[model samples]
Target: MTLQTVRSDILAGTVVFLVALPLSLGIAQACGLPPFVGLLTGVVGGIVVTIFSPSRFAVSGPAAGLVTVVAGAMESLGSFSLLLSALVLAGALQLLAGFLRAGRWICLVPGSVIQGMMAAIGLLLILQQTPVALDTDGDSVTKIISPDSVLVALGALLILALWQTRFIKRSRFLGRIPGALMAVLWGSLMVLTNDYLVPGSLADLDRLSLPEIDSFSEVAAQFSHPEFSAFWRNGAVWLTAVTLALVASLETLLSQEALQKLCPQQPQPSADKELLAQGVGNMLSGCLGGLPITAVIVRSSVNVNAGARSKFSVLLHGLLLFCCGLFFETLLNTIPLASLAAILMYTGYRLAHPELFLRQWRLGAVQFIPFIVTASAIVLTGMLTGLALGMLSQLLCSTCASHRSAIQLSSYSNHFVIRFNQNLTFLHNARLRDLLAKIPDNSVVIAEYESAEYMDRDIWLTLAAFSEAAAARGIMLERWPRAEDPQLVDGGVH
Candidate 1:
């Protein structure tokens, strides 16, 4: 709020704005929206949302991961405007989620699943952007890759290597310059110079255009307005809207966690508040014929890297977008698609590093298998379905392990004892069911846990339920807490 603070924010925002510009456009294009909408969200997200957001240093804008979903919705609705309406609905849901303090639910997602998601997204990025980086053009996703892309990818790899080299790493001046940004600049210049020396050597850069605000109706017409009658008639629309809201919320929560790691001094944003902020931003952007917005990790990292001390950095970045749109629109069009593609490819690599998976594998197969399965599902199918399958697999694996470690039960005509050797979970609840079913009415039951290391909530709840049922049966239940208890009766119980 102060002048000094304002000055620092301006500097930080400038850096982030530079980083966000290409990304916003590329993501918007990928989502099948006019690139301008991406810019609009980036500007609005920074300028407007940051004012009320809890995380002062985190930046928000169009996210690359949401591109496919947005595109599919637009295609399904047969109108971009209707998708906007869905975005508004999605935003409203997010706000409600925030108010309900449901953001904490993100923590319930297993860490392995999250790692798998990031890795999959990274792989997707490399696949999608590599072609663009090489200036390849084809109508379909498969056609995007060419020999040229392979060369360009190599160039990008070299740039990354140089950026990580000790000389650049140790130099304060050099380290401050983001290697991704530098690569884009160098690549753009190389393309431009190549064009001058040998015409048509590089792909024609005639596709870029400056967005103009001719009339409000023109912008409004771009989006396909939701038909209330149609929406009610079809359940699919509602399902899609719910899916968007849930996925967007999860991504935002993850981005917030990542942002906190990047800038620890800043207070963490309340999940609910963060949700509301993103919802409002998306709602407004969609209303104006823009794409959906979310807490993007790349821009947030850029803000932190740029020395942003507060949310004002976001505001400043938005201001820059507004000014560019208002005054220097033409200059913005000069940026080549290839340069933007390079930026995305770099971002993708960071997201889907192979080494992350290697590290997870080292932890244990229980952790690594789920992570790989989740990643594969996401790539082969879609995000939500893959995640569901992964979670199910994790549950099954856990249950099997628990079943294998279960203790045997022995019983007499009047008394019975059941023992467990390992921790218990919901997966192991069935064992209790079988044991209790066999116990005779009015029998004495000894529930032993001497070998148990831990018990999850589900197991505890099941036991509590069994205790109630046993009481009804006129059965006395005694729990042996420790292995050293006097009533060993070791015979076969050990």
Candidate 2:
């Protein structure tokens, strides 16, 4: 990359690092780990992966979607260290998948499913962070936010509104800053003012701290080693690990693809190389007592928005994290939890905003219904499950709607008119068969198929059969010349 590109990348990277910092920690906390582990993963993903990755703009780190899996793994393994072993195994699996060229299969996931996944994640973030935004102590996902949280959410919402208004858009100072970041800064000020105005009204804000990883032995003691002897005995653990790997990889591949589309200067990464980078990142992260890491869309979006032009942005982000960890720990810790909540709530709103659904609805119900169902399923259930169901529903709807071909057929007493609008395939054979059955023997039937652009083997076979039947019935079969079919109009035949 050129110096200008490098400088731009660094600027973008800084923006992404700031946005990712709190999110990584929050995800770690949500997954029942020390917040520092999340920071460690973010650093490693930014620094180490950037060196080996092919994608110029994609940012990798701990993802919120895998929080449920990590939390469950910790509970099952009975220690964070044991969970690390599984992560190592998970990394191995991803590497193996890359080598096997399985990354291409991710493209098979339907667009509806991917859209649903995004919408679900957005909703999950909203639900999880709403409590934190309100300064509530609620930890349960199902818990309702108190009135205080409602007010705080509204205040953050107002900040987002002001940031989006034309006044801020035209302002030199505010226009250059990200609206979401501004919302966080304003929300932090609001929290401090509330604390000062009414003492003890807001809960005591927790201080940030450097993750404590003093010794290798301490890391070793966090969890039991992976039980190879009981590998078959504890099938559940293996299954969970494999599931986690798949989900993480899917998210990574999708994020990389989306980033390439969003960032004009950044080309898409080689899927296999990305897999290896993530595998190495996860292995190191797990060893460092951190949560599993993957490419996150939110941070990638921030990087793109901040004018990132190359992979250096990821490296710069890692350097920032390392510097914060080594020297600016105290300053980082001073950031209030509510401020982070405000940032996340704003992110969530952008992801699943009502306008997106409304826009999808305008496209057609075929697309909109699946989008709504996917979003709802994610809101009601978890991400992966919701995606699976939404994809199935989309496939069913598509298949049911595609039962018959679009070619229209009409028949008169003496002549039969078969007007083909587009391509004909096996799907159209049934309709063609029904139309052919109504033709009378010894009648003059003009089999018109001029509008047909292409015909598959099955349709060709059907036509040949119909030609034979029409010949026996003394009916004339007339067809226009198709570039691929030179037999058309041969001596007033086919």
Identify the leading candidate in terms of lDDT. 1
Tell me model 1's lDDT, rounded to 2 decimals. Answer: 0.72
**Residue pairs with backbone atoms closer than 3 Å in model 1 (clashes):** 56-311, 80-224, 81-223, 81-224, 82-224, 98-272
Give the per-residue lDDT digits (tens) of candidate 2, residues 315-409: 88888876666565554554555555665666667777788877877877667777778778866865556777788788876764554445555
Poorest stretch of ten by lDDT in candidate 2: 485-494
- The reply for model 1, stretches above 4 Å from the true place, is 1-3, 134-157, 194-207, 212-229, 232-236, 265-268, 404-448, 451-494
Per-residue alpha-carbon lDDT of candidate 1 for residues 400-454, written as tens digits (9 for 90 to 100) = 6558658567887788988887766666777767776877889888877767656
Give all candidates' CA lDDT scores.
0.72, 0.70
TM-score of each: 0.76, 0.75
Q: Which candidate is the best by TM-score?
A: 1
- What TM-score number comes out for model 2? 0.75
